[model samples]
Target: MTIPDRPLEIIWDITYACPLRCVHCYSESGRRPSRQLRRDDLLRMADAIVAMRPYGISIAGGEPLLVKELFEVTERMTAAGIQVALFTGGWTLRPEMVGDLARAFFRVSVSLDGATAEVHDRVRGRRGSFDRALRALDMLAGAGPVFGIDCVVVRSNFGQIEQVCTELVPRFPGLGFVSFGAVVPEGLASRTGFAEHELLTEEQMAAMGAPAFRERLRALVPPGVHVTATDNLALQMHPDRIREGQFFPALQIEPDGAVRAMPAYEGTVGNLLTDSPAELWRRSVERWHDPFVVATLTPVRTVREWAEATRRIDYHFASAADRERIDRRPAFAQL
Candidate 1:
């Protein structure tokens, strides 16, 4: 495969504030202090993003809707001809907002963990979240945006994905796809106490990314609907992707201004608030070759091990001023 000359996508997590604390949350979202930039910072960051102009940006969040001026930043990026996609928990997505979301996002994805409200709400840690999500889906149905489902296939939701897709397909006839994913051990899921009930086994994680497994799931869905299992574990296997500084194939900007190639790791290449995204990308390319990155990843033979390895690669800002400020962070440590 040809290595990309530039990033194909920028996955920007606009805000770290959310309405739910889902059991498998990678960022421990709602539990952490808010990482959203101020309105001015977001605008300045938007300007930098437009100028840098990677192929597209996926605007993800703890829940993007929580941000008051979210659309203003998205509108600016889209005006500059950058394609945008959105990811939300669907808690605050109003019916009126559906049309605007349709206009701004190339595709909008809403998370749903299970087929029934009982199962979905349990994963979400909110009593009425399942109803709100389904209500949001109903609001989006045939509303002009190409919409889809994002399901994290943990032990509880694993058996329900086929049902999640089949049951909803008729209700929302044009739903794009049901994207299934396994958990990454970080944030709350990383804790030994919490991992037992939800985390997948080593074998389950392997099978989740297997082509034969994906195809088998696809076979169960309707002709118009697509079923996909996310396969990012393969990125850890590709030395070229790591060597090229495209380990994620997307530049990840955490809720704070810190920009990183990989989110599971705390090593930030630069901050969008004070640095050029393009330069940060180049900096990231340079850092991957560091002996520690290779040494740490070499022994990670399974998805669980890789997830653990992710948090172990700690990097700090290059600016001396930044170094002083970054060292105090709870997430950062010397490797």
Candidate 2:
């Protein structure tokens, strides 16, 4: 499929610093206060990102809440008529903060790795994380913009997925969505991350890999609740849901005033301040044949591959849903 003309979503890591050091964190989310994006740098990035006219901006972090100035930045984004989404662990949310976020963001997403505190705290390497996350949900429910929860599907929680769905949905009927993300075993979580027992085994993956699992999960999802799995996780569905909105401007300005290609791909891409955002983007476009974007975007075809593989399975989830409710299907599918 051809890349979308404009990015459909842009993720702005408010800070790389996070409160918890989860074993399976992809961004290497940390609590290094020193890495926090500066106010001026954030404003500049925001200005450039808002100029891109993407569908929405996702504000993420080590924990966005760690950055005291996030609300201020969010305020500016809303004033600029930009839609925003916040990604947090929900440890810091308070009653008043929810009201403040409701006016600023389009929606909010919090992470909860397990249905039970024992499992959650162990994975997070912090005590009371699960309780705080639940409380955070209470504070977020109905008090602000729609909010949802993100769970990292692994061997430990795969069994509890149904429980999480059953327990959380009726508990907070106003949630915007629930996403089951496949555990990305990289970075700090690669070697020393979750113990072997915590990781999903091949057998469990096979069970979750079935077309029926996808169908059943969707059926179990509450109406108006979104359940998204990445192309890498469950490929038995539409390509657009997995790949349509995958691209974004591959540039980010760091906290220390250094300009770089995406934050995740920092260092490999030259600095923006030293080089020029426009020049970098142009070079990046010219270097499309280079590994980074091409390599990353190539696998997205998996989404379509999955959809085709499971075409025989009843696509009750896709066919019955309102077209407007779902993301655009892969361009090739329209062909």
Candidate 3:
């Protein structure tokens, strides 16, 4: 398929500061990173985003609530007529904050790893995190902005997928959808050596995409609830689509102001603060020509390629020399 002229969506990791240390956090965020883009810089980038006019932008982070100027940023974006989505762990969401978000017409997607407190809290690495998240969901339900649940499917909570869809999701009044993201073994997952233990095996991932399992999930998911799986590439990357070529419709802005074609991939296209969003986006599209990016984007081919890409990308970020190489390469060079 031909690539779109512009991105359909942008996912920005506005800050790398988070309150919770989830076992599978792709950013490995906890305490605020020592280096982050200044508020003025980010606001300036927001201005550029307004100029680009993507259909939607998802503001995310270790915990977006930690950003002191989050509300200000959201208001500016909303006032500019850009649809914004807030992706949070929900630990810091307050009634007043929910009200603000609702007024801005921002959509919220809260993380919920399991159906029950015990299961959820265990993954979040906090004892009462599940309750806090549920409370935030309740507040958002009545606050008026569209909201949904984001669950990272891992070995610990895979069995509760049904309960999350049937029991947990239906209890929230304004819940719009439930997205199941396959746990990617990157970031903290790799650092802690939990990739092998926590991530679903290749066989398990394939099983989740099997016709019978998908039908089971379909039957169990309640009416009015839409279910989406981010890592269900086995079902999405059809052979024909691969042959024809496909493009992912989103770009990501990291907390430090770097723009990347894919969040998990370590290649930086540009910095949102110093570079125009349009130019960065153009580079993101051009970077697709890189063999590494092509392998990362192409799915249902082999688990080994995916694993190696993740490892190499992770290593690229881990090494200063590698990052220097990226900085020196041409804008369209394979990251």
Candidate 4:
């Protein structure tokens, strides 16, 4: 299919402040400052997205439940006839909020990286997060809309993908899809200290995305439910589009309002705070032909390579200067 004028889906990371510190966190969320746009600024961003009018928009963050205006923004988008969804770590997701959340969101995903608390807590660097996630899911299970879990396939949890699907599928009647994200080497997973023990080999990642393996896992769940294994590197290749010279990468709106082509890389297209989303959406159509993008993606084959490839690209501020310093200082080090 050809690239649409509006992105099929948009992922907006509203804040970097999180409660848990996962080893494979793409944003190093809790470790970084929560560069939240003020309440009015956030509503303005929502207005901008409404104007862009994408098919769907996912509201994500360190923990979206932490943002007091989470539902307000979601309600605005929903009122504008846009499909709004939220992906949360479930740290502060309350039972009271689940009813309204189920009503407003197109899909509600709570992360459960592992089936058991022991494995999950270890990977997430928090003692009681597993239970909290489960409790949140329980509240949301039959509340309304499409409810599901997001499990990142990692070194320690590689074997548990099927187990998570089978166990979770029958448990939550409202559950729709289980996404097995092959952890890309970016953010915290790219940190020098984390690169060695935490990352899974390329072979292991491929095994899950393989068609036969995914089909087998899908059989373990009900027929209506879907299971998918996605490695972001494969997405960078834009496998389904069949186009040449240009690709429509996953559009991500960072907490500071920058619109990044792919969340795994720092290269940005524009910032909503500085430019209209409509204007930035127009620019995104031609971003694939840039010499830097072409050269960077030409040799990328694996998730780890994706991390190495982006280091050489010169990230820019098409709308405004960068908002934060990526530091190696002791105080600013990875958590």
Which candidate number would show the highest lDDT if scored against the true structure?
4
Stretches of candidate 4 off by over 4 Å are: 237-248, 314-335
lDDT (Cα atoms) of all candidates against the true structure: 0.73, 0.59, 0.71, 0.74
User: Which RMSD does model 3 reach against the true structure?
Assistant: 6.0
Q: Candidate 2 or 4, higher TM-score?
A: 4
Q: Which stretches of candidate 3 lie over 4 Å from their true place?
A: 31-34, 190-192, 210-215, 232-247, 291-300, 317-335
- Candidate 1 is scored at a TM of 0.86
**Per-residue lDDT for 1-335 in model 2, tens only?**
45444445556666777778675655556633446656777666666666656677788757888787788878877788888888898877777687678888888888888888987877776889999998888788777688898887766677788777778655785887887766543233322224244445656655555666766777786788776653244222123333553334334434433443333232323443355545655553343344544444344433223222222121222234212222222211100
Off by over 4 Å in 1: 1-5, 194-197, 235-247, 314-335
lDDT of 4 by residue, 157-225 (tens): 888888897786678776788888877665556554445555668788678668988888889987778
Clashes of each: 0, 6, 0, 0
lDDT of 4: 0.74
Error of 2 at 200 (Å): 4.0
Pairs of colliding residues, candidate 4: none
Candidate 3 lDDT, 134-204, residue by residue in tens: 98888888678888898888878988988987888878886888888777655554333455467677776
User: TM-score for all predictions?
Assistant: 0.86, 0.72, 0.84, 0.87
Q: TM-score: which is higher, 1 or 3? A: 1
lDDT of 1 at 251: 74
lDDT of 3: 0.71
Give candidate 4's TM-score. 0.87
Model 1, range 31-114, lDDT digits (tens) per residue? 667778889989888887777668989888789988888889899899999888898889999877977897788888999988
